[model samples]
Target: MTQHVTVGIDGSVQSAAAAEWAAREAHRRGLALRMIHVAGTEADALERELGGGAELPGRVAEICDGIAAAWPGLDVTCEVQPGHPAYTLAAASGRAELLVLGSRGLGGFTGLLVGSVGLRTAARSLAPVVLVRAESGRTDAPAAATSADATSADGAPADAAPGDVVVGVEGDRPCDAVLEFAFERAADLGARLRALESRPTSHDVYTTQAPVEQAEIRESLAAAEQVRLQDALARWQDKFPQVRVEVEVCPWSASRALVEASRGASLVVLGRRTARVPLTGPHLGPVVQSVLHHAHAPVAVVPHH
Candidate 1:
């Protein structure tokens, strides 16, 4: 079976943007694109607006047509499923190369940046889920345009140099899946990989100790952290020699550091740990949640043990 890129679609602008992003990714990866629409909830109303039943397929067809137009030569397919949106989308991830969804959906509080369906799907999906906001714009652009013209207000390129992938490293529980995904993406794009490790400052040690002791303690801790981070990345770095690796060790909140790094990143990769107790449900860590809500680039939430 050919694994294709999948995106959950409703009538929302965000989902439309996700479909476009997924189409571009599928084309770049030489894979097909699947646009999935789960019936029920707000989608039912959308179906009705599109004339329902026979006419509903037209709406999906229209979306597929637009994607085909945007990404010529790319294979695209559409499906309408009947079930809870989150559960259906999560189940579809099992067979997809990657699952993409919008950060915000239609049936949610205005202030909630990420909707419940997207959150639940990201937490439960076995495959990596990429959350794209409408503002992410069309990712299918010429290399020159994407690398040089997409700029911030200050006239700096919005994305990482030309090809740069950023992955957040958790020292306590470094996820192999996340690291592998980052390295693989960088290798595929012939890009550079940046591994970011963040640790909270030891405020107590600094506050209670003398200046000399503080200097010694801080230096000691920083050295140990650098060594640990290098050890964690050693095997992977060796595995992908083609990918130039850069390691950043920061004394700050992981979320803040990752979010800041994402400003110029092609993609921000983070790990979602499965809940030990199934009944407690999926546990998306604070860092992952914060990055998803704030990162400027598309965020990939890779689930790992």
Candidate 2:
């Protein structure tokens, strides 16, 4: 069966770009395209007054029309909803094969990756979420050239597979679920899977340890941590021998490590923290927010079991 991809459109430029990217992806994957507009609190009164008439639903239709025009003969639907954008988005993600959105919304001031609805949605949604950001002309243009060369050099078909799936592997046990989800996605795409892990730095070690003997002890503890990361990767390797898996172990912050890994990756995978846990909500957490904001690729946040 064809995949079903849904993208939230708020009539913003970033959302429009997301629509365009989602439409292209839907066409490329032979999937259905859905355009959704979640009416914000500010727009609730307007929605009640207009009731699916022009401006609200009409704008959504325009965005969908643009997508349809770009990829003629593609499945497309437009919808306008009332209530919180994030709640509607999270609920819509339940049955969607994939969810696409822009990094920043109609709001103002977008830095490299500060904060936005895209980050929140990516953190909570069970479905894989793609955050479409403006791409650099020079880097984005070389895809055709690189693809052609890849096929010619390796005897690999031009469309041999889809894109690489990147998953974050922390020392935390919950990351096991993240690895499993990413491996499954890689299997589906016939793409490679990359597992990235980040450890604390030696500088932090020096600061925390005062005595020479204590410093040595801390060093040993850090080394053990790295060893645990290797063991985790080994388990994944044992489970999915056929999948091409690349493991990255570093001593940087988890967010920075993920962002670096996501540079050329098609999707970034993360594990969601439990709500009952302290400082584990979708919007909070350093590593979660960092990867969501900074990574150029789409992110897939899976719940911890």
Candidate 3:
């Protein structure tokens, strides 16, 4: 790992918020902070100037300076690179321990769509990617964390009590890397870990079973799911004994369950396949794509084989 946190800066409020979040995260991880602004070379400068993007460099500089002064002794650097935004950031992820980007807002990524920079970079990133949302009314993040504050994105105030770090677990396709990331993050924040698994309730129209029988069937399925989830989390729980682990087995859509869990969570984590599947899903699973767009908390997309 490169031992640094990389954040894309575009001078928007959302990007500024992302920069602030990345700075705190860098401090927590004891890593350097790198702020990169992407605009084409001299040849493309005229286009940028004509397009009214000339002021971005100055704004990026100001943001960098503010963060640097606020967190003394932090190695913060700003650079202007020339290339496509998505491709450049994806490449940077290869050399970064984590990549942070601004979510929907003015001049920020409006959506994690198929042709958008956010989705493209997240899909191709070598390291984990975190998407931060900062709207006009969003509170300014503190320069340093003085307390165990777990401000949430889903309507929780800045001074709200610490919240759990929720992680979605695919029982059938259990991913150790995803679990490891979640455990490490929970340990870092000294927060609780909620391992949630959502199952689609079975509905057999052809069956002539009684209503009581159906209830029993559903109960049995839930029990089996609970056991599976517990088994999958056993090793991780042992590894991070300090982290309080809570498991949930619900009969509902995975995306819906995850979105609901994100409401009061400090951070939401899910896994993505290392290989791109080339579909509307950004090569990421459907559930992941949905959660990325709708998640109330900052979502961490971890890549695994």
Which tens-of-lDDT digit does each residue in 61-166 have in candidate 2?
A: 5566666655556688877776678778877888787788876521234354534576667667767677776554323221222223333222322344466788
Candidate 2 C-alpha RMSD relative to the actual structure: 6.6
Among residues 3 or more apart in sequence or in different chains, the pairs in candidate 1 whose N, CA or C atoms overlap within 3 Å are 160-264
Clashes of each: 1, 0, 0
TM-scores for all candidates: the values are: 0.82, 0.70, 0.82
In model 2, where is the ten-residue run with the lowest total lDDT?
138-147
Q: lDDT value for candidate 1?
A: 0.77
Can you tell me which runs of candidate 1 are displaced by over 4 Å?
A: 42-51, 54-60, 105-111, 136-163, 206-213, 276-278
Better by lDDT, candidate 3 or 2: 3
**lDDT by residue for model 3 (1-305), tens:** 34899998776666777787787788777799998887754644875767745444666667777677666656888887779888899999999999998777333452542236777788889999998777446654433332224433422223434578999998777799989999998998888999999887778533445556767776876898899889989888898999999999877798999989988788899998886564654477779888878777788999998
Candidate 3: how large is its RMSD?
A: 5.7
lDDT of each: 0.77, 0.67, 0.78
